[model samples]
Target: MATSTAAARREEARLAYDAFLEECPTGQLLARISDKWVGLIVSALGQAEDRSLRYSDLGRKIPGVSQKMLTQTLRSLERDGLVTRTVTPTVPVRVDYRLTDLGSSLGGLLSSVKLWAESHFDEVSAHRDTFDRATATS
Candidate 1:
């Protein structure tokens, strides 16, 4: 009885996930993953041979990222179980961030997207300029 009830609940929850829906929970996830800082942070950590980086190292690697934004981004990643935050006990204490298995899976896909964007920057900029000029005339 209890087993069947739990299964039913699980099925119901699964049915509720729909990324195309305006109010779906997955929409929030999309927004989180699509954030600029999130992409940069994930890319930085993902490219590491060890897939780990300290907070300070991440700050240095990603330019223009505010301390508060980094803190927030890391917290969100940790909360979503995408990254693992480890702390070491020491005189000053040490903290490190690394990709979990799930994060690692996303790393390759996001890395590809980053590469594509970098490779196409000039072409995209020209298109944007053309669009802007055409729109300005209208």
Candidate 2:
């Protein structure tokens, strides 16, 4: 009976989250996951069969990411429990990163978002051009 009661309380706690509320932590979570770099990094890590890559490899795979930015992003993801960083002792230290189970679950969602952006780029660009022209005339 005590076990059942605890389980019920846990379920209730899980159900209490509401992203729409101003104080809800889920809003912060949404912001982190929706970030462009976060999405790209998650997708890149997800693509690897081992779901892991060295810091240099990640930097190479993701063009235009500054070393500082990549380091910051990886640290953030690690803090959020989405990725794990492993350091190997070698002649030169090696560091590798991999997505956590939670992060792996987000792969498909991020991939879909990437595909949508790519597929709709032209349409979005046309709209932006039209808007810019109208704003200029006004």
Candidate 3:
């Protein structure tokens, strides 16, 4: 009786997840993963040879990221269970981050998107310029 109720609730929750609906869990997840910092961090970690990098290394890799923003983004990723944080007791307590299984899946998708942007930026810019010029004349 109790087991069936729990199963029914789980099914209801599964059915309620619609990414297009802002109130859905999937919608919230999409919003979280779509953050610029999150995408960059995931991409950096995914490209690592060992799939892990020290906090300082990440800071160096991501340009223009203030210390506060980096720290906050890392905390949010950890909370989302997409990245794992490991600490080693060394001279200064070395801390490293690696993407979890979920993060790896997301990273692959985001990485491809990044590559696509790099490959097509010129075309996109040209199209934008054409649109702006045409609109200016209208």
Index of the highest-TM-score prediction: 3
- Which TM-score value belongs to model 2? 0.83
Which residue segments of model 2 deviate by more than 4 Å?
Answer: 1-16
Question: How do these models rank on lDDT, best leading?
Answer: 3, 1, 2
Better by lDDT, candidate 3 or 2: 3
Measured on C-alpha atoms, candidate 3 has an lDDT of: 0.92
Q: What clash pairs does model 3 have?
A: none
User: What TM-score would you give candidate 3 relative to the actual structure?
Assistant: 0.87
Residue-pair clashes, model 3: 0
lDDT of 1 at 64: 100
| Regions of model 3 farther than 4 Å from truth | 1-15
Instruction: Give the per-residue lDDT of model 3 (tens digit) for 1-138.
Output: 345688898987777996776678888888888888888999999999999999999999999888899999999999999899999999999999999998899999999988998999999999999999999999
**Residue 133 in model 3: lDDT:** 100
The alpha-carbon deviation from the true structure for residue 62 of candidate 1, after best TM-score superposition, in angstroms, is 0.5
Provide the lowest-lDDT 10-residue window in model 3: 1-10
Candidate closer to the true structure by TM-score (higher is better), 2 or 3: 3
